[model samples]
Target chain A: MARTRLTPEREHELYTAVLDLLGEVGYEALTMDAVAARTRSSKATLYRQWGSKAELVVRALRNDKPVHLAEIDTGTLRGDFLAVLGRSDDCRMEKNSALLRGLSHAVHDNPDLFQALRELLIEPEMTGLQLLLERAVERGEVRPDNPALSYVPHMMIGAFAARELIDERPVDRAFLLDYAESVVFPALGV
Target chain B: MARTRLTPEREHELYTAVLDLLGEVGYEALTMDAVAARTRSSKATLYRQWGSKAELVVRALRNDKPVHLAEIDTGTLRGDFLAVLGRSDDCRMEKNSALLRGLSHAVHDNPDLFQALRELLIEPEMTGLQLLLERAVERGEVRPDNPALSYVPHMMIGAFAARELIDERPVDRAFLLDYAESVVFPALGV
Candidate 1:
C-alpha cells in the first residue's frame, strides 16, 4: 500500500509521542485515538501512514534504535559486543529495557506486533550477532561445534530480561560487559 | 487482618479459575468481577480472601508452582538444575512460560504485583538457587569469587525469556537441560 509522508521533524515528533504514550500506558492500553490526540493528528492520518497500531508502534521502536548491530564490525567478537553496549548509555538502556518489558506481553498477544518485531527489529540484531559469532568461529576464538553458539542470542537477551527479576537492578553497560567477560566469553571458550 | 477461609477444594477451584482467566484475558484486562463470575463466587469473597487482585494473582501463581527449589537436592548443581526442569513437563512448562510472558508487563507496571512476586515466587526460588550454588561452592565446583556466580539466575531466566524471541521455540526440558550443559555449566567452569 502507498503511504502518505510526514515531514522528518513531524514524523520524529509523532514517534516520540507514541513511545512516551507507550511507556506511560503500555501496549495493551495504547490506542490509535490516543496517538492521534497526542500528536494532534487525525486517526485517519495515522491509519493512512502506518496502517495499524502494531505497525506504528513497531516502526516507532525501530526508529528509536540508535544503532543497527549489522553495521558494527569491530574485528573481534568481544569488541563487537562491547560496541553494542557502548551505543546506549545507562539511562537509555534502562528506559529501553523497561520499554521492552512493557511490550513483552503485547508481543505475546499480538501476532502482527510480533511479526513486525521479528521482521524489523529482532531479525536485524540476530543477523548482526550471527556475523560476530561467525567471525569468532573463523578466528578460532570459538569452535564451530559448540552448542552454546546457537544460544548466543538467548544468552544476551536473557541478560536483559532477567536483570530486574533476579537482582532488582537495571541492566547497565558495566554489568553487561562484566557478564560478557565472565558468562558469555567463557561459555564460548574464548 | 484476619482472612476468610475457604475449603481446600473450593480454594483450588477459585485459584484455577483465576489462572484460567489470567491466561485468557491477561493481568491488565482481568477483573475481580470476571474472577467471581468464573468461580461462581461473590466479588466480596475474593476481596475478603485475597485482599486485592495482585495478592490473589500472586497467590494463585504461588499455588501453581509444582516444585519449590529448596526441596530439590540431587547432590550436584547440574542435577539440581535438571531436576527443576524435570518437575514440569513440556506442555506445562510452555504454559508457565506463556503465563510469565503475560505477567511481564504487569510485573513492571504494578508495584504490588512485583512486590508479591518477589516475596512469594521469586524470593523462594532465588533462595533455593542460592542453596544449590552454595553447595557447589562448598564442593569446590566453582571458585568462590567467580562473578558469573552472581548471574546464574539471570542466565536461567534469560533462557526462558529468550527461547521464543530468538528461536521461535518453546522452552522445554530438553532445551533447558542442553542450556544447562552448554551455556550455564560451561560459564561456571563446571
Candidate 2:
C-alpha cells in the first residue's frame, strides 16, 4: 500500500506519542487508536505509514536512540567510557529505564522487533564503542586482545538491567563513575 | 484464605505445570484455567494454594533455579566458576532461558512477583556467588576489594541477557567458560 510520508516534525510527534504510550500501557496494550487520539493522526495514516504496532514501536526505539555516538576522545579508553557514560543525565537515564522495562517483554515475543532493535540500536552503539576501543588499543592504553572489548557493552546493558531489577538504584553519574573505575577499568586490565 | 497444602510431590507437579505453561504461552497469555487444565487440578485448588497466577509463576521460577551453588571449591576462582558454569547442561539452561523470556515483561509490571523472584531466586544465587568470591579472596586468587565483587552477579545476569537479546546465542557451558575466562576473570584482575 502506497502511503504519504509524514513531515519530519509530524513523524517526531508520532514517535513521541508511541514511546509515551509504550511506557504507560506497555507494548501489549498500546493501540493504534490510542496513538491516533493522542497524536491527532488518523488511523489510516498510521497503518499506512507503519504496517503494524511492532514496526511503529521499532521505529520509535530507533528514533529515541542517539543517531551517532557522542563524539568522545578523552585520550584513554577509560576516559572515553567515563565521558560517554557521563553524557546521559539522570532524567534521560530514568526515561530510558522505564521505556526499556516496558518494552523488554515485547522484544522477546516479537523476533522481528528484537532483530530490528539490535540492528538499529545495539549494533550501531556497539560499532561506535568498538571504534573507541580500537583507538585506545592503537594508543597502547588498552591491550589489543582485551576480551572486555566484546563484553563491555553487554556489561553496561547488564548494569542498567541490574540497577532496574536488583537495587532500583539510580544509574546516575556517580554510580556510572564508580562502575567505570571499579568494575570497568579493572576488567579492561587498565 | 486458608488453603489446603499439597504434599511436596504434588506441589512439584503444580510448579512444573506453571513453568511449562509459562514457556508455552508467556505470562500475559497464561491463565489459571490453562494451568488447571494442563495439570488436571481444580481451579479452586490452584487459587487456594497460590492465591494468584503471579504467585504461582513466582513459585515456579523459584523452584526451577538451583537452590544451592553446586558446592564448588576448585581451589581457584576460575576453576570454581568453570565448575559452577559447567554444572548446568543444555537442557536446564534452555528451560531457564524460556521461563525467563516468558516472565521478562510481567516482572516489570508486577512488583510483588518481582520481589518474590529476587528474594527467592536471584538473591540466594548471589549470596552463594558472594561466598565463592570470598573464598577466592581468602586464597588470594582475587583481591578482597575488587569492584567486580559488587558487579559480578549483575554481569552474570547481563551475560545471560546479552546472550538472549544481543547475540541470540546459547548461554551454554562453552559460552559461560569463555565469559568467565575473558570477561569475569580479567574484571577481577585474577
Candidate 3:
C-alpha cells in the first residue's frame, strides 16, 4: 500500500500544535511524546519525520514566526527605523523574546537544531535588518564603519531575552521599543 | 584537640587546587570528591567551611582574580571606559568567563545555587559596574536617564563572554578593546 500523504491542513495542524505546546511547556521541557500526543499523531510518526525534540521544535518555531514586517522604504533613516521598530506597541516583541530564549537553549545543546534555528529563523530577520541598514548606508545617514552595528541587535534582543528567561520577568513592548529607539538605534548611529 | 587553623599558605594552596579543578572539569562536572582529591583536603572540611559549591567557587575566584580596576574615576568618558574595559583584558577575565559559565549553568538550574552565586560573585562585579556608570552620569559624561546604562556593561562584556562561551572561540583583549571604543562609547552618548 502507498504511504498516506499528509495534507497541508494536517501539516499546519501539527506545526501549530508544536508552537502551542512550546509556549506552554517551554523548549527544554518539550518532549517528542508530548508533541505526538498533542497533535494526535503516533510517536513512531513523529520520530520518523523528526529525529528529536529539538529539530521538530526548531522547525516548528521557524514555520510559526513568519516575520511580516511591512517593508516601508521611507526616505529618511528615522522613518525607516520607526517603521520597523514602532510595531512593538502590540507586545509581539515580548512573545518573540520568550521564543528566543527557548530557541537559544535548544541551539546550545543540539548542533543540528542550532544550524536549522539560525538558518531558518534568525538569518531572515537579521538579513532584513541588515537590508534596512544597507539602505541607510546608501543614504549616507551613518558612518560606514560604525562598530556598534556589530553587536547592537544581539545585545538589545539577547539581553532582554536572557534577562527575562533568567529573572522570569515580562519583556514588555514599551520596553522593547524604548530599547530599539533609545539604545539600539543610537548605537547603530541612526 | 581543636582543628588546625589554616595558614594563608594553606589557603592559597587550596584556592589553586579549586581553580585547577574548575578549569579542568567545570562547575557541573566538579564534585566535592574531585575537589578533595585535587587538594587532598577532607570533604568534611570543604562542607564545614564553604557550605556548598557556590560558596567554595565564589571564594576561590575572588581569592584568585587579583583586583585590577574598580571605581574608575577617569575624567573623560573614553578614559573611564578604557579603565574598566581594560581590566577585562587581564588573564583574570579568562578564568572569570569560564567561572561565569560554570556558575551560570549551575545557578540557572538551582535556585539555591542561583542566589548563592549571585550574592557572592556576580553581585559585586555588577555593583562595581553600576557605580562606575552612576559616577559617569553624575559627572555629565552620559545622560542621567539612559536606561541602557543599566545593562550596557552586560551588553558589551556579557555579549562577548556569552559569545565566547557559546561558540568556544577566542576572546582576546584587542578585540574587546576595539569593541569598547566603538560599540560601547557610541551607545553611551545616545
Candidate 4:
C-alpha cells in the first residue's frame, strides 16, 4: 500500500499531538493508536513516516525546539549568557519540563531515542553555546582554560532542572539575571 | 480480614522491592499488583501500609537513600563541599539515577509525591549543606554575604545533573573533585 505523505502543516499538527500526548502519557504509555486517534491519522501513516514512536517524538522535539542557538554576539559574555538563558522565557517551561521528565525514564530504555535526543535535540544547542564562549575567549572576556567553560551548559541546564524539580519555580527574567550575575559570572570569573 | 502489620525487617524488604521496581518499571507503570508480586506481599497489605504507589515510592526513597546529610564538617568549606558531593560514591549511583529519571515524569503529576520527595529527601540535605556553609562563615573561610552561598546547592546539584545529562558522564569521585576544585571553589571564592 502506498503511504500518504503529510503536508508540512499536517506534519506540524502531528508533532504537536505527539508532544502533547507525551506530556500526558509519557513515552512508555504512548501508543501509535492514541496518536492516531488524537490526530485523526492512521497508525500505518505514522509508522510509514517514522519507523517508531521514538523517531516520531525525537523529530517533534527537533522541529519544535530552538535547536540552534541564534547568533548571540552580545559583545560581553554576561550579555551573551543573559541572551541565551532569557530565551527560555519564550518556551512553555511547564510543558517542556514535564515532557523531559516523562521521557527521562524511557530515554534510558530506548538507546535510539536517547541518541537522537542527545545528538539531534541537545548537541546543536551545546555547539552554539560553546561557540558563544569561544568568541568570548577570543575577546579576552574569559580565560581559555577556565574550568567553568566546560560546565556552562551544565550549570544552566542543571539550574533549569533544579528550578522545576526542587525549587518548583519558573526560570523567569529576574531569575536568569540573578543566576547570571551570582552563579555563572562568578564561576567564569566575569 | 485484619491487616498484618509489617515488622522493621519486612518494611525494609518492602522498601528495597519498591525502589528496585521503580528503577525497573518507573512510577507511571508501577502498580500495587506488580509490587505485591515482586515482594510476595498481599496488595491489601501494601495498600494498608501505604495509601498509593506515590506513597510507597516516596517511603522507599526516604528509606533507601540518605535523606539527611551527615556531619560533613571538614573544617573548611571546600572540604565540606567535597565530602558532601563525594557521597554519591557510597550510593548505587546507576540505580539511583535510573530511579530518579523514571520518577521525573510522574513527580509533577502527583503533588503528594513531589512534596514528599522535596521535603523528605531534598530539604534535609539542603539544611546540612547550609550548616556546612555557616561553619565556614564563622571561621572567616567564606564571607557573610557572598552571593555564591545562596546558590551552593544549585551549583553543586546543577553540575551533578549536567555531568549526567549533557556530558553523558558519571558523577564519580574524580569528576566531583574536579568540579569542586575548578567550578565550585572558584565560584565560592575559596
Per-candidate iRMS values, in order, are: 1.5, 1.5, 3.5, 1.9
Please give, for residues B1-190, the per-residue lDDT of candidate 2 as tens digits: 6666799998998899888778877888899989999999999998888878777888887776653663677888877876766666778888788777656667766777777778777777777887888898899988887777788877787888788667767688787777777777888888
* Best prediction by DockQ: 1
Model 4 lDDT tens row, B1-190: 7767789999999899888788776788889999999999889888888887777888898787643565677788777666665665635766676677656657757788777778777887778878878888899988888887777777877876788778776667677777777777887788
Candidate 3: tens digits of C-alpha lDDT, residues A119-164: 6666666777677767777888867787866665556555564455
Q: State the DockQ, from 0 to 1, for candidate 1.
A: 0.65
Question: Residue B93 error for model 1, in Å?
Answer: 1.6
Docking class of 1: medium
Here, model 4's chain A TM-score works out at: 0.83
Worst 10 residues of 2 chain B by lDDT: B62-71
Model 2 lDDT, residue A118, Cα? 77
lDDT of 3 by residue, B74-104 (tens): 8776776666566565566766776766665
Residue B51 lDDT in model 3? 85
Q: Which candidate's lDDT is highest? A: 1
Comparing candidate 1 with candidate 3, which one achieves the higher TM-score? Answer: 1
Candidates 2 and 3 compared by DockQ, better number: 2
Every model's TM-score? 0.84, 0.83, 0.82, 0.76
Q: What Cα-based lDDT does every candidate model obtain?
A: 0.86, 0.78, 0.69, 0.78
RMSD of each: 3.7, 3.7, 3.7, 4.7
By DockQ, highest first, what's the ranking?
Answer: 1, 2, 4, 3
TM-score of chain A of each: 0.91, 0.84, 0.71, 0.83
Which ten-residue region of model 4 chain A has the weakest summed lDDT?
A: A85-94
